[model samples]
Target: MSIAQLTVVGGGLVGAAIAYGAARSGISVRVLDQGDAAFRASRGNFGLVWVSSKGNKMPRYARWSREAVTIWPELHKELLELTGVDTGLHQPGGFWLGFSEQDVEARADLLKRINCEVGGEIPFKMMEPSELKQFLPGLGSAVVGGSFCALDGHANPLMLLRALHAGLKEKGAETISGVDVTEIRRDPDTTQFQIIGRDGQRWKSDRLVLAAGLGNANLAPQVGLEVPITTTRGQILITERLKPFLDFPTNKVRQTREGSVQIGSTSEDVGFNDGTTTDKIEWLARRAVATFPALANARLVRAWGALRPLTADGYPVYQGSTSCPGAFVATCHSGVTLAAIHAFVLAPWMAGLTCAPPDIECFLGDRFRDPNASFSHDH
Candidate 1:
């Protein structure tokens, strides 16, 4: 059989990362980027490689994130090898601050559930405010207690996106922008995907990757896939360049590689509204300042908002349809957290080079297929 051409239906983090990995493996690939107006989370992410407290509700997701983080080093090396770009990845450790006793209790319970599901492979600890001081030398007395997870880390998301694009190009993948894909149709008798755009361009390929983020919901059904993905709004605030006081990232705040403080991420259930709000930013600033009083002096520089492409149950969805064998759908909120796995593991699977690991079936879109199943609420 002749080699097949592949078309990845989005140019954001997930699609770009997967395309880059596939290209590196010597597959011919093209990425369709829906121009700037699309909800591009790759440009708007917290940039943390987080692994703790992900899957209390979904163990498969928790495992996938852990697996993703474990492979990040090699992914970083691959990016550097191709483009000489360092993604500013740091994995020393990270924290979760709780100013109230109830906050501490909530996290304890959450972790307890997560641990019960994992059978103890994942480690976490509850730290007293005093105990936290030693590990985190920068002190803000208001933090009553907190949790620590060694698996969490940080990286420059923009740099990673740039590097992935460059590396994919170096590996001979074609990336086209300003193309609004209006339709994707599989060939009637072949394992090929015929991609059609609003601008009247036609693209034919043997495989398709549905990674259009929140837009996946709109594009998936045409190809026999259920991209039952939702959007959660998160806004990030940037502060003026500051002294490097934060060694690790917490949910509320962290210091960037460029010395700016990135504080944010309001997880509002409001659907598809990716706009920054004062109330959310104020809440984030108060929490950050409470965690590190020194940050009170930092000047606010900028703020922006993006929607997280979340599955209803808050895990990633990766599946290749039996209805359309060469068509695949991939969606996730942890784009930064799972970039490594997408590039290394998921990409190879889509290329027919590797089988889904033992737990992969649980993530397939078919699980949500039953219209009357209790889980059907997920759609």
Candidate 2:
């Protein structure tokens, strides 16, 4: 087999970010993207460059997400420099709104456990309806309370994707859209990898990075790795451009730089369904209006549904295979939040260099207890 250079098999945020970073290092890369048919989490995203209330069950993941937040500004500048695309990156702050006292208390307790490890950032004052006015003027009085964290922000996710794609090419990465990778064959003894496309075009690379979003689980077993991932459908509602009244991003709504409000608050366990529903869109619009009355008259410009590439444990999975020496897999829920870390940190590690800045073993997909734990093998 010819000595492989570098071949990445996905073009969504996760794969595109890592591939762009690695290619920026001057390695040759081929990104086989499925294009429109692929469940594009990037399109349906709320576009919050957020970092609060993540990794509740695992401190390691919390620290990782926070690290990415700090690294994001530099990345935005780099992307703009490379592609002349300003990503509209903003970091005034973010909010988690609540309609009742119990909701505030519950989220507070959850943050309490996760924030202790990150230190000081986890706990914030419960935003009484009055205090909420300081952060969110014109907030509907019906809003019971909220939580504010300084460690959060928002950006145009599509612009981020556009910047990443252009920057990757500027860095000399080959991004092939609509090409589906059918197989990843690895020589058990030689550690050689050949990534075959559905059209029978084969790519031989000494190193392979599988960041294929929900498509990783099926690809991992061919290289003796595990990617325990499942799909959770999330929907979003976008309101017509209006004067911005909301300053910070909430889980249910965020105002984009273009002055359009983005509303999202639905998570369903439905499998492989990526179509938005009228009922859900209406429900989210109503919730957003309840929190911020300014949104009541705002006409909905768009709505969408897409699968969140989620793990059962709700933490990222980063691992290399014992059976396939040169192949590695990386997947996570917070792709936008963690794009910088994937570029600066995980890219280097996947390049086979030793000495990571922190302990990353916890993210290995193999942590699942079941020896035969099944995932989306056919996906």
Candidate 3:
């Protein structure tokens, strides 16, 4: 089996960013995309490059997210220059609104704990309604308080995905779309991986990366990796383009560059059913209106659901197969927020250009190997 220098079996944000980064590093790359039918969380993304309440239990992940957002602009700029595509990144900070004092207090505690555990790098402010209103004048009366994180922000997720794919093409990487990868086999003697499609199409490469989102659960085992990946359907709502009212992105609602307000996301453990429900849509709309009274008059134009590729503890899985050298698996729900780190840091290591990040051990997939260990997926 012979193909490019690196074969990435997933063409969404995670795969594309890594592929683009490897290509920019002068390695020939090929991306096998599962196409439109796949559970593409990239397309249904809420577009928040957020880091406020992440890693509540693990400090390493919090710091990882902090580092990712800091370097996001570099990826954005490089992609723009290389592919002439704008990702619409905004880092003016973001908010997490709450309608009850209980929830607000818990949020404050979580943020404070995360900040302390991460060595005070994840700065946040617990704000009263008045202070929040200063930044968000459209704040509704139902909102009692919120937290603000300077490192939090948002971007056009679709644009970011587009820019990465465009940059992949510009960097001379091959992207094979509309194909389902059915199997992956690693030849121990040759140290090569053969990727087989559903239709028997096959390609091979010296290095293989399985960043296939939820699909990683099955594919990882093929290459001697154990990734415990679970899917949670997140239903989101989008309103028609409105006047620029939202100056900053919030957990519940955010106005896009195109003026449509993105109201999201209910984390339902419904097992791979990526379909929106009227009840969830109404809940989102009501909450958005409660967050900003101005949204009461907004007309909802679209609603959809996407499955988030989460680990047992909702952190991430970046593991290289010791049993099968040159094979790796990368999976995380924070694709948009972590795109920069994936491109600039993880890609180089996966392509054998540099050593793995020092903290890579913290995100290994085997952490969940204990069958008796109980886990949570709050991310």
Q: What TM-score, computed on C-alpha atoms, does each candidate reach?
A: 0.95, 0.94, 0.98
C-alpha lDDT of all candidate models, in order: 0.84, 0.80, 0.90
Model 3 steric clash pairs: none
* Candidate 2 Cα errors over 4 Å, as ranges: 1-4, 121-123, 188-190, 371-379
Q: What C-alpha RMSD separates each model from the true structure?
A: 2.1, 3.2, 1.7
Return the lDDT, model 2, position 250: 78
lDDT of 3 by residue, 1-379 (tens): 2234999999999999899889898899999999898899876788999999989878899989988999999999998898889999999999999999999999988888888888899999999999999999889999999999999899988899999999999888999998899899888788788899999999988999999998998999988898988888898899999989889999999999889999988888899899989899889999998999899999988899988888889989999999989999999889999999999999999998999998899999888888888888675
The regions of model 3 sitting more than 4 angstroms off are: 1-4
For residues 221-300, write the lDDT of model 1, one tens digit per residue.
88878768777788889999987877888877889888999987777777878888889889989988888888889999
Local error of candidate 1 at residue 23 (angstroms): 0.9
Q: Between the candidate structures 1 and 3, which one is better when assessed by TM-score?
A: 3
Alpha carbon lDDT of residue 330, candidate 3? 93
Write candidate 2's Cα lDDT for 1-379 as tens digits: 2223777778899988888877777667777788887888887777887767777667777788888888899999999988999888888778888888888899788777778877865445557788879888888877888888787898888888889999988988887788778799886666678889888888778888888888987888888887778898889888889886777887678888789988885777789999888888878888888888878788988888989788777788888777787788888877788888888788767766544557788887777858675433111
> What order do candidates take by lDDT, descending?
3, 1, 2
